[model samples]
Target chain A: MLKIMIIGATSVIAQETARFFATEGAEFFLVGIPADKLVVIKDDLVARGAKRAEVYEADLTDFDKHPQIIESAVQAMGSIDAVLIAHGTLGNQKAAEASVEVALKEINLNLLSNISLLTLLGNYFEKQRRGCIAVISSVAGDRGRGSNYVYGTAKAGTTTFMQGLRSRLAKSGVAVVTIKPGLVDTPMTADIKKNFLFSDPATVGKAIYLGMKKGKDTVYAPWFWRYIMAIIIHIPEFIFKKMSL
Target chain B: MTTPLNRLKQYKSWGRYPTVEHKAIHQIHWRSDLPDVNQFEETVLPYGYGRSYGDSCLNEGGILLDTSYMQQFIAFDAEQGLVRCEAGVSLEQILEVIVPCGWFLPVTPGTKFVSIGGAIANDVHGKNHHRAGTFGCHVTQFELVRSDGTYICSPTENAELFRATIGGLGLTGIITWAEFKLKRIPSPLIDQEKIRFANLDEFFAISAEMDQRFEYLMSWSDCLSGGDSMGRGIFMAGNFYDPPLGAEPSAKKLKPFVPFDLPSIALNTLSVKAFNAVLYRVPLGKRVRSIVHYEPFYYPLDAINNWYRLYGKRGFLQYQLVVPLEGDNEPIREVYRRIAQSGEGSFLVVLKAFGDIASPGMLSFPMPGVTLALDFAFNGEKTLKLLDELDTIVREARGRVYPAKDARMSPENFRAYYPQWEAFAHYIDPKFSSSFWRRVTASAKSANGQ
Candidate 1:
């Protein structure tokens, strides 16, 4: 069984990813904010055929506690085969635009905190020389949107960080997969009007799991997002600036 | 305190009738995330796939623990044919993996979209029920987490909780995970045969004769048929047949889905009657024997994805009831006559017989009887009154209505049919409550002082 650590165990996508691993009888060390929900997820993971489902409650934004969380997971599982960083917030863009404080906090939560965790996990996986690290970015990261530019900017920075990390870890055999998903129908996006463009979390979850397993460097979830983003990226700055996307 | 992820939303059961707004729709993606059962003052119910045809899956103003995110397959023993999985793992998901390994669900409901937890809570029965019994019978054990503590229950361990949780309608507590045995099949194909039955008597006669021979048997009756033509329908029976190739055919990745809800007038009695008449003649006109894939054989409605949309935005209710196989089929005949006389002809009227096998669930709907299920478009009071009249006939015959398929069964009759309600009620964790439970028990307390 693959020994895996999920940073945000309760997020819809993370839960879906955990399920994908559970089907393979992976051993999971789950970390989420709510203790009660973590226990519930652990129980569910165990039932879904996980070899072991150990849980720890810690706010992902608490940068100081990152190393200890990883230490605890390593201690519990003895070793780790994969680390899936699926914790991020779709911070309210209107608030971020209105206040510098909100923008800074959103950046800290979405990017800085993730970078801190990755730095620690990257070092650990480099030393181990055999593991996979997957992070969920967003299609918004491909090009900033006026509606969610704050979240998009953080994701863009994280995606670039992953690209560099992928290059750094290329020779070490540690896979760094950057997943960019389009309009996933998670609770974060529940209020967003659902349409044909939206993807189910389970489907995205499967894609993330498979992309990591296949050791793909960077992938757009559902495959279609890659083409959609490609088209958006090619738009002239003048046209893109004028368009309200 | 409520979690940050909590949100309020409108919820509806599969029937789409009686939609209600939930104040706290907290989705528990993990067992540990659940609040201590005692912490919540408001009513609560674990909602899994919301596949129940009625209010059993609804909580109204109460909190709904959405379990869809908790789906996972925990363990699978190919040698023993046992699969342990989280309560939220769907039948469709299970089939995708297990069917390839030559294992099939021991019991399955009509729709595969339902979660394992919902199936057990409802003690759903399938065409194979005559031989395999309800879904609860095959479940070896399950873990139920309540407000006080968590309990691991099985037939030999915490057996009372085990019995209570099955067909318990999520009131016993939240079922986290369950282990059950799987039936093995040589291939995904079934050797199927369809026979035309002119009346209800022929349905009974043919069912009795074929019960032992076929592993799965069910019939579709013409709901509008009355008098000399009453109960005219088609009878279908099947046994697993080895595929020409050794492998069970892999299912398609994409299935066609209904785009949107049709108008309420889209499916009226006239349309249903015409469709039923056409269906009645199709089998009768030909020699109906074929080796077919199990997908259509087991789940015909599944072929038309989101077919419930056909019922319209107002939604529809399926009134499925069972009467004991006593007194020369008079009770079942009366039921058909009343439905026809009411002019609420349902296109999806199914008739089947349950064998002598009894399920372990205290509130399980299956018994040694004949069950008739019909789909009726929601027409407010008119539909409810029709169901009430049907309930009277069922009560008179000492038969029971399926809570999973019933939105409005009288509390007095619920208690009478399920005398074990008092016993089952004792095991219900105070933290867990549902619209069905509240409606039934409140009325039971007022009407009969139970």
Candidate 2:
């Protein structure tokens, strides 16, 4: 069976993502921060039809501990075919302005933490020369606006870093995909607009699953987002900067 | 009549036949009748229609068994759309009988002159190659006559031999007959959309977008242009024609065959370049969808019968190669640069996307990549040298030249392209050989000698 490790397994997206990979006959290495929540998620994944599921509790902010955590995961499950990096904190922008520490924490969790994990995974995957790294960035990164510029900036950096990694690892047989999701309605975005153009966490998870198989370099969560963002980002700067998106 | 057999020899008459090498010659003892094929064993090269543009047919004094007269359909299942026929049958022959019945060959090469055996041997690709893959992908099964003089090979039994034989260049054995899956169509016509692009970037974007809907796609490039216009071409995307009310009569007319060869200098660089320029300039729009006949859409050059004669007495060499899309167009750009510098203007340059479907043949040509095919007249020693240089480029890029259209590629190039060549060679019957096989193997041996 193919070994797949999903970082941040207790998250809402991870629940559906784990279940999807399980039904596809993959052995799962679900990693999250909390032990009790991971146990419940693991049971849910197996009850939903996972062949085998293992959970690990590790804080992603502990950069030095990532290597061992990943090594243990790879050891628990046999050779890993894919690494899904789906860990991030969507801190409230208004609250972030109250404290510089909070703003830095948002950047650390969203950008630096994912970069550290990817750097470690990049070296491992490059040596193996055959694996996939699927990163979940948001469409907010397509262009920074007043509404979510802080979160968008972090995602933008993540997306760019993935592009560079994709180019470097192309000939080595390792594929790096940057998934840009638009207005996803998860617990992460529960208080946002109800009738807004938004994709569910399951829909985004399925898109990621299919995009990896197709070897697409960058995928918009819902394909319409490709054209939607194309037009949105192409508007003149004067007009785009004035609009409160 | 028995007075003097020597005196009777002076009155003997000989009839000329066309060959793949563009040479007209008389057949010695070889005839179509199977009983008269005592000279034919496993070593003999069986040729039909003689449209292979290279030495695949002429074995250079070796036994050449003519299979053109083996044209007869054994069975046809209208319900399932399956066809079983002798190897000698031609596409034109099938079209004549089946077009009225609303059936068509699943895959066809550029020309209708190819035989069923030649099609299987070459594993021909058509406009729809991007979506459907190669000819071997659709072939259900074929009966191969092996060295043991026993014909007992199908897709399931002797599976390796079946895979090797399809694109094996007739090296494994003689293909006596084949059963293929036929495609059912509304009529012998096409609904085409001509989309023109000013430069390479537009061409790439247009082709990728059109690939979503169209079943058939082919592009024509102006090889004479350089720099920004290097890969500038026109894209022709089409699907099976759907006739409008009260307009079905035109599709029923039988196409007249081209009986005579054209003038020698009819297709010069200036003429072809001018023709391509006009073709590229005429269709200037997002999409121009219209009703067109099948002969023009699928076989555009077939309008001029004996079109190869236009290349002069020297014949022509077709170079076809496929390179994986490594997310960069630099390799393709380099090839076009080399060809442009060579000052050899090709009459027809076709570019297509080879889809995700893998080839079943151990040595089949098409893979998940982008394929470029061009035709050049044999302009003496320089033409061969230019092709060899291009072969080197392809080899370095981990790409391969199509064996069916190749006459000059070294065996090293063959091995590099088909990693399973040794495995394919294991299935080769000693009794079966062709001039194409001898030249390639000898070239390979010499390369190894060096």
Candidate 3:
């Protein structure tokens, strides 16, 4: 069984991804912000056939605590086979535009915090020379939409950082998977009006798990998002800037 | 009141027969955070999956406690083959974890999209009902959360609540979590056999013989068949098969999809007849025995995601009724004859014989009878009138219609089929009500001069 560590275990996509691994009888060290939610997810993982599921409550934004969290997870599992980073938020774009404080707070949580954890994990995995790291980015990162530019920018930063991390870790035999999901019907997107294009969390979760196992560098949930995003990325900047998305 | 978590929305059942405007909808994430049925100023009804196909899952001008977000597996005992999961967990989710481990649901409905809670509430039956009984028979226990407090109910503990909650249409309370036994299967493949029967008597004879040996038994009838050809269809039976270790469960991914709604004209008489004709001819003259994956054997319709879109935006009313086979199946034949004569044909006409195992639910729909289910495109009054006629035939036969699939069932017939409605009513949380309950009760009260 694979020894997996899931950061932001309480998030809908993370919980679903954990369940995918749990079904394979994997060992898990779950980290989330809320202790209660973590306990619930941990119990659920065990029920889904996880050999072992342990949870730690720690805010992912606390950069200083990243090393300790990674250490605890490694100690709990003995060895880490894979790590899934699925904690991020769709911050209020209007509020972020109005105040630098909101923008910085979102960036810290969605981008910087993840980079800190990745750095710590990178060092450990580089030394060990084996493991897989997967993170959930968004289709919004392909192009900045005025509606959610702040959140999009954070994901864009993470996606680029993952590219660099994947290239650096390639020689060391560590796989870095950047998962870009489009319009997932998760609790995070509960407020957003959904259409036919929306993907279910369960579907996205399976894709993330399978892509990580296959050692893919960049994976798109729903598969169709790859082609859709390709067209969106190539839209002329002058026309894209003038048109509201 | 305007919070994203608790916002007013218009919701409809899978049938899309009746759309109701609810005061608000609260998507429950944690069982601890669930409000009591009485806690809401407006009435509350727990809605799961929204695949009930009728008004049973809907509440008008009330609060719908959406439980889809409450999905979580709590505990599982591999040795005991028991699974405990939050009520919102879908059968599809459970199958993902258990199927690979040589375990399967004791009873599964046509689609795996329905939630565990919804399955229990409807006390749904599968083709193997002749062997396994309704879904509730396998349910060991479930916690019912009400306005007063949460209560644990099982066969031996708070047994009345357990009986009432099953097939209670979610009136008793919101089921927080449930534990049920899973049947152990040797492999994810089924040894399937399909035989075409010429008439109702042949169908019955074939079913009786198959039920004695097969683990699962069901049939599909061409509703347009009449005269000597009436009830002519294919009888299908399956048993679990052992496959080689290299043989894997069909990957859940790669579903064939129906991207958009088909025009209403696409399901018209000419089109439906054409489709049914082609489908009925599929078996041909060859011996219809094959080793098939459990996915196709159990959930053939699931192959096409959103196949319901074929019914169009107006949706179709799925009229399903069961009549006991005490003397003969004349009453059952009469119901089919009326549908055939009316020229209102359902694309999917499933005829199955229910086994004699009585469900523990007070208002469970299935009994020792033959059930005929048909989907009539919603053409307003025309379809409703046709359904009323079918109900009359069912009432005369002493069989009842399934409430979970009914958008329109006369209260008189419902009372006749389930005389235990008055007894079941006492257990209904006053804080809970549904559009189906309101429609049936109000009509019944009016008929009784109330």
DockQ list for all candidates = 0.20, 0.00, 0.33
* Clash pairs for candidate 3: B37-B147, B38-B147
Q: Show model 1 residue runs off by greater than 4 Å.
A: A1-135, A143-150, A161-178, A185-198, A207-219, A222-245, B1-10, B243-270, B284-287, B444-450
List TM-scores of chain B, every candidate.
Answer: 0.91, 0.86, 0.92
Candidate 1 lDDT over residue span B1-450, tens digit each: 001111222457878877878877666655545666566678789987777878888887889988875665667787799888778778988886677678899988877888888899999999998999999999998999987788999989999999999999999988988899999988776778888888887777778888988899988889787877899898888899876655544434212221211223344434887878877887655347776677777777765655667778989988888889985789898888888899986878889999878889988889999999998988888888898899889988988899998788878878877888998999998878888888777745445523
lDDT of 2 by residue, A36-76 (tens): 66765565455334567788999989899999888998799
Candidate RMSDs in order: 6.1, 29.3, 4.7
List model 2 lDDT by residue over B1-450, tens digit each: 000011111110110111333122222111122433334543566666656666666565556655554444555566677776668667775665556567888888778877788888878888887777878888888887765665556678778888888888877776767888888888777778878776666777777788888998888777778777777878888899767777774663634432112123445545766766766676657567776678777766656655666676667888899888776666777888888899887878888877877767777888777789988888877888888888888877888888777767777777777778778889888766766677666645545424
Q: How many residue pairs collide in each prediction?
A: 20, 3, 2
Best by TM-score: 3
Worst 10 residues of 1 chain A by lDDT: A40-49
How should the candidates be ordered by DockQ, best one leading? Answer: 3, 1, 2
Best-matching candidate per DockQ: 3
Interface RMSD of each: 9.8, 37.4, 9.0
Tens-digit lDDT track of model 3 for B1-450: 000111222467888888878998877888777865555788888898788888999999998988877888888888889999998888987887788777999999988888899999999999999999999999999999877778999999999999999999999999999999999999777778888888788888777888898889888888887888888888778899876687754534312221211223344445777866766777876338777777777887766655666778899899888998766689878887888888887888899989999899999999988998889888888888889899888888888899999988877777877888999999999899999898788756545423
Worst 10 residues of 3 chain B by lDDT: B1-10
What are the lDDT scores of the predictions, listed in order? 0.82, 0.72, 0.85
Q: What would you estimate as the lDDT of candidate 3?
A: 0.85
Two-way TM-score contest, 1 vs 3, winner: 3
For candidate 1, give the lDDT of residue B435.
85
- Looking at model 2, residue B129 earns an lDDT score of 78
Q: Estimate each model's TM-score.
A: 0.80, 0.58, 0.89
